[model samples]
Target chain A: MRRILSSVTDGRGFDILLVSITMIFLLALSGMPLVYNVVMSFQEVDMFNLNTFSRPYAGLENYREVVSQPEFGLILKNTAFFVFGSIAGQFVLGFALAMFFMMRFPFAATIRGVFLVSWVMPGLVVGALWGWILAGDFGVLNAILKGIGVIDSTMFWKSDPRLSIWAVTIANIWLGLAFNMMLLSVGLAAIPRDLYEAAELDGANGWHRFTTMTLPMMRSTIGAVLALGLIYTLQQFDLFPAITEGGPANSSNVAQYWAWQYSFLLFDFAKGATVSVMMLGFVLIASIVYVWSTRHEVRG
Target chain B: MTPQIEIASVDKHYGAYHALKDINLTIPRGAFTALVGPSGCGKSTLLRSIAGLESITSGNLRIAGTEMSGVPPRKRDVAMVFQSYALYPHMNVLGNLTYSLRFKGFNKEQARKKADEVAQVIGLTELLERYPRELSGGQRQRVAMGRAIICEPKAFLFDEPLSNLDAALRVHMRMEIRALHDRLGATSVYVTHDQVEAMTMADHVVVMRAGVIEQQGAPLELYDNPANKFVAGFIGSPAMNFLDATVAEDGRSARLEIAGKPVLPLARTLQPGREVTVGLRPEHLRIDTAAPRLQVPVRVVESTGSLTYSTTETEPELMIVEQGRGRYRAGETLPLTIAPEDIHLFDPTSGTAL
Candidate 1:
């Protein structure tokens, strides 16, 4: 009896030690950035001054000053257009492509393999390639347009302030398409063939089956894709910097680039952290709404 | 209304593998025809082909005198109850039943009215507003049936609709399906591997083997006179027992010699000295003390509440189903008798009845 009790205690001790180690690793992973961000956003700091590690709270002044900037509203609007436009475009095109590939067609596997290349390519590489392609002079697009006699001469594609947002939006759409397509494709494949057969027997044609069966079955995947797309697009900085650099006259400046400008370019870390915190808040609220609306679809 | 579904020399292939071969069958109007076979026997494939879920490689199919060869499943006017129930997870029970009707051009009011009628018939009126996830397995099955029945299509296709339920629920649902068929009198094609379900619910059972029809007949006809040994073995529970035998000099009756001791008589005509297989159902074997037909040593004894099963090993292993009680112990020799009328003889080379 004593031996058995001791062995049981030994087993429980190992379990407790394992749980403690896991909790320590989790705290190191999740708690570090949260604590750093909270501290930096609340403190008055600058790039030139190294006081972020030891600064005191400035009581929402940083947030107030950040919001009082002239370009804040414009940046917010550009961020909204970039995120919403890119996500919407990716979803529509990606879902359509996914459905197309889902059908029984020849060389579908080869086509899918080709489509996946864009997703596996690095974001920097994609931005650089699009940057060269959208260049005003000696660009393939302008050359084609001129060759087709659609335009008299090469136009300033990325330099024009009016078309800069669209230029950035197009690049982001291309980058995100393959991700959405792969996710929605897996979701579509998981649906049983019997459901489609049953629906067909129930007087549902191809369109009806897609709307009722495919759409509902892919709801959770759509939600995940949309949420991730929204979050990534809202925090987008790499592609814009490489492609347009938030020009002409900051027409394509998103929240993340604006925040980077404040911190690194303008040397106001407090205001940049303030912008970051605000963007994070918006993302959290949007995510919460997305999760709440899609709760039933997820469970079902 | 007479139900009429006909398939003429339908052929279907998947790459090099022939999933279905030169299949021809006619399900009479208002008849419940069951496609019964083991898994991968193309029973479901045949049902799907009839439902137009699968395209036929060749030949013609018709329902209600209209060609169904190129028609889609929806236009074929047939409703299928999938094995998984396939209830729309997002929709409530009422929504599931009414969703298809809207596409069929039924107005919202008419669809709702039809859904209500179906709900009442299936005893799912209370669960109509609830979602599929909220319902039990049996309730979901009823909802699936209700979804199919609400369409009032020309024929109903049931693809192992009750296989998901537990044994007790399956039995209950089987009876319910039979009653539903009797009342609706719909031309139904049901696919199931379980012979009991086919035997109980089907007006005609089409036994398929390797994508070909082995036999097609009424349940009792198939039981009483099997066309082949596969049907004989497949139809009954505990399965029919087979032993090597030779035709006697009389030609009409054959001698089934077991363990070189007990020789049983089978009522079938065969060439004398010809090797044949003798089949006997477990229920036909009885425990006799005085006039024992065949004796064998008991191997295993299983006692259920109603009936007892004693598995015996003679020259060939056999299962003996007896009523009430079994006094035989393991390794104990017991006398087993089968009535000559119940005996079945099949050609050893080809599994065909003599």
Candidate 2:
């Protein structure tokens, strides 16, 4: 009787142990920042009164305040411009590079090796290098422009409100081009050589082959690259912070940078949490739309 | 219409390796010529060169009296069916057939009409609306044929088109292709490693080995009179068996001695005491019990419904094909007889037919 009782206790203990381990793994995975952000977005907490151990609830008040801010509207608009502008430049340049690589040329391998270097570098390092290159005073670009007599005087690149957005966009485009090029190059190579042979037999010249064969065959690849680009560009914060610091009177500030400023720098925890929550919502909506548009391609 | 294709002294090289060497062929118009050889024999390369897919290193290919040295595949007015079918995955069967027509300046209605006509001919009219992935292997094969025929190109090039099908389907498709050729009377150059396909489908067969043409003639001509031992061994099913022998004096006949048994009076006129190889086909050997016969110990026996093949352990291992049920048992000494006229004699040194 005692042995039977002991075995029952041991089985119960084993079940409890398995349940605990599984719960820990799940909390680490899907329960970390996503749930924390949700909980904190509804909590009422001030910067000075912040206690890491405290529990508080505000019930949508933070969300309401965040939406009512005047800067929030401008931040949203700037984010849109940054995402779309960066993605467009990256795709165009990347696609061109991919096409160039596809040609049968000497030193093609060497060129691919050189292009891969930029993508492999840390994003922080890329931002820092571009920041120096785009600096207004004593920068190489301004010096070269002045020396060549293209411009009469040195122009401030980061400080000027009109040019700051363009400078940031240029930096992001350079950093993002490598990704698009590599992916599209793979797509181009995956197409069967026989298709091209067949198309040529069908009387398709260079332009006809490109429009009818190359473009249509690359539809799934293009859709995948564009969708990924949109998502990655939407959450962009590193380049703006490292290079421009959302500076020149906040003219180039994106939503992610704004969220970081409210949460970390300003110590307005409630409002910062609200901003983070809104950014999450925006990302989810964009991803959902992208998936819906490319469902057929994904299935294929 | 006599649409002759002549490839004169054509040579192709890939870097340092010579792919094709001095290949010369004449394919008469409306004749179905098959290039038959093992893989890497440059048969497909030669076919692609004819289709203008690969540029020849030297020499000229003339189709209907026009030199096609610098012509591209599109301007050559020839169509090709690849082994993989190479159908456009995104397009349905109808779209696949009409894709080339659009580039040829045919309007949508006209292209569809032509596609439908070819689809009916290839028995793919019911499958026009289905995608390539949705169709079975045989259906996709028919669609590929439809795509090639819809353009009505001057010549058709097939690179092992029926290789991907099952054995039964391959046989069925082979007959379909033959029927299609009869109806269209299109000049075609087909490449395959299967000797049966070459013998059955080709009006003329070109046997190749090591980047050179061993022999080229009508199928029956090659079977009856192979120029060399290589052609003789490669052109027949169950392959011709060769035995070492020496010619008898007076140059009238050859004597082949196998397993201490004298099988003499082989019909050949060679110098006396000259070494030679005697060739025999399995079907020519008959199992006889009446008169004096060449005795052979049977090694293995395979019985099909129509014929029985028995392998014998002689000087050169021989395969014997007999009609109907064969009463010969394994491990038994069987008496076999060969007709005097059915013998093929070859020179021992040069391996050429005497």
Tens-digit lDDT track of model 1 for B14-109: 989898888989988889999999999999999888888888999889899999888878888888999999888879999999977887789988
Per residue, candidate 2 scores C-alpha lDDT tens digits across A57-130 of 78988888888887777778778888889999999999999989989889996897699887788767888888
Global Cα lDDT for candidate 2: 0.85
Task: State the iRMSD of every prediction, in order shown.
Answer: 1.4, 2.0
Question: How displaced is residue B137 in candidate 2, in Å?
Answer: 1.0
lDDT of 2 by residue, B1-354 (tens): 565799999999998989899999988889899999989999999999998889999998998889999988888888888898988887899989998898788999999899989988998888889998899989988988888888888889999999999999999999999989989988989999999999999999999988899999999899989888889889888899888887878676666767764555656566898888888888888888885457889999899968999998775789999898789889998888878788888888899898
Clashing pairs in 2: B3-B29
Per-model DockQ against the true two-chain complex:
0.66, 0.55
DockQ of 2: 0.55
In model 1, residue pairs whose N, Cα or C atoms come closer than 3 Å (at least 3 residues apart or on different chains), thus clashing, are B3-B29, B3-B30
lDDT at residue B64 of model 2 (Cα atoms): 82
Q: How close to the true structure is residue B305 of candidate 2, measured as C-alpha lDDT?
A: 67
Instruction: Give the Å shift of residue B75 in candidate 1.
Output: 0.9
Candidate with the greatest DockQ versus the true structure: 1
